[model samples]
Target: MLRNIPPLLSPDLLYSLRAMGHGDEIVIADANFPGSSIGPTCIRADGSTASEVLQAVLTVMPLDSFVPDPALTMQVVGDAEAIPEAVTDFQRIIDQVADNPARVQSLERFAFYERAADAFTIVQTGERRLYGNIILKKGVIV
Candidate 1:
């Protein structure tokens, strides 16, 4: 109900994004992701697609520019060379919002899970698309 605030962002998710400091990472997980078990703080964003959640989050959150690749997506297992359709949508969203959008990097499935485990928070979306998981690093507003 807040004006200008993306309705897709739950209060908890908004707070988490605001509270995160530069370099802190947040995971936008798909329905299959075990966010509750792995994330330090998990926010439920059910009923929404990961692409929708990503676009909403990017409206307020800035992508980390200090790192070479601040946007990271989970690589398809058994087909590391393949790029999931969801990831392509993610990149398109990033390219639209980020001032200097960095190319999305692909992480091996296990590596992505390991990295998600260390994220500041994880937003579990309702996206049913396989390989919908992605991680984004926070950048200073400057």
Candidate 2:
């Protein structure tokens, strides 16, 4: 019902994004991510892929400018240097939507989970690809 909001963003998701302040993080998790069990507030975007969800979120939220890597992705297990297709798509979205040059950083499996646990909220998406989870830190508008 909102004028410029992405239709994919539900009321709860939109409210969460608006409530978050600078430096707060939100996780756009894949279908396999244990978002509910990790303990932070979890929102469901089960009809969209992680990439789709990421694109929509970046349209309304600004990425942290104070940090070197405000975006973090889960590293592929057993292959720390490998970048999955989902991660590639994430980077592409950031490049397209972010106001500044930003790149996605890889975090080890457990490290990524821990970070997600600490996030202000987690948006669990329907993406079926492995290593599709990404964490985005909020930044000031100015």
Candidate 3:
């Protein structure tokens, strides 16, 4: 294992994150996502949950502060006002990494897919909870 690096980040993942340019997006999706078909490049952390993957990714990936919404979560179906418990938990983790910069933006399911299409890669995690999906935009180190 590498020192100071989160163990959840595999060698391939690290390479992809480093290779991605500013504004490039990365999807940390739940097990239910059809990543194999949707994601251009897919990383499988089959046994670990989405929260676990999110934590690892945040350790290395910098969130784009240039945009109003660097973090995007899936909106509740039918009821846009409803915030599921799973999303709440993920929000807490994201807030910690974001340094409380701005609130996460919720996107319609179809829009979320369109946005994720621009991601450099997608990490399909083992989180089976509904709405356990999030997309993050990469930012410059400076």
Task: Indicate which candidate wins on TM-score.
Answer: 2
TM-score of each: 0.97, 0.98, 0.94
Instruction: Count residue pairs with overlapping backbones in model 2.
Output: 0
Candidate with more favorable, higher TM-score: 1 or 2: 2
lDDT (10s digit) by residue, model 3, range 36-96? 8885699988988888888788888788878988888899889887887767877788878
| lDDT tens digits by residue: candidate 1, 46-107 | 98999999999899889988999899999998899898999999999999977668899999
Model 3: residues with Cα > 4 Å off, grouped in runs: none
Provide backbone clash counts, one per model. 0, 0, 0
- For candidate 2, lDDT tens digit of each residue in 15-56? 999999999999999999998999899999999999999988
lDDT of 3 at 50: 83
Off by over 4 Å in 2: none
Better of 1 and 3 by TM-score: 1
Record all residue pairs in model 3 with backbone atoms less than 3 Å apart, i.e. clashing: none
Ranking by lDDT: 2, 1, 3
Residue clash pairs of candidate 1: none
Question: Local error of candidate 2 at 98, Å?
Answer: 1.3
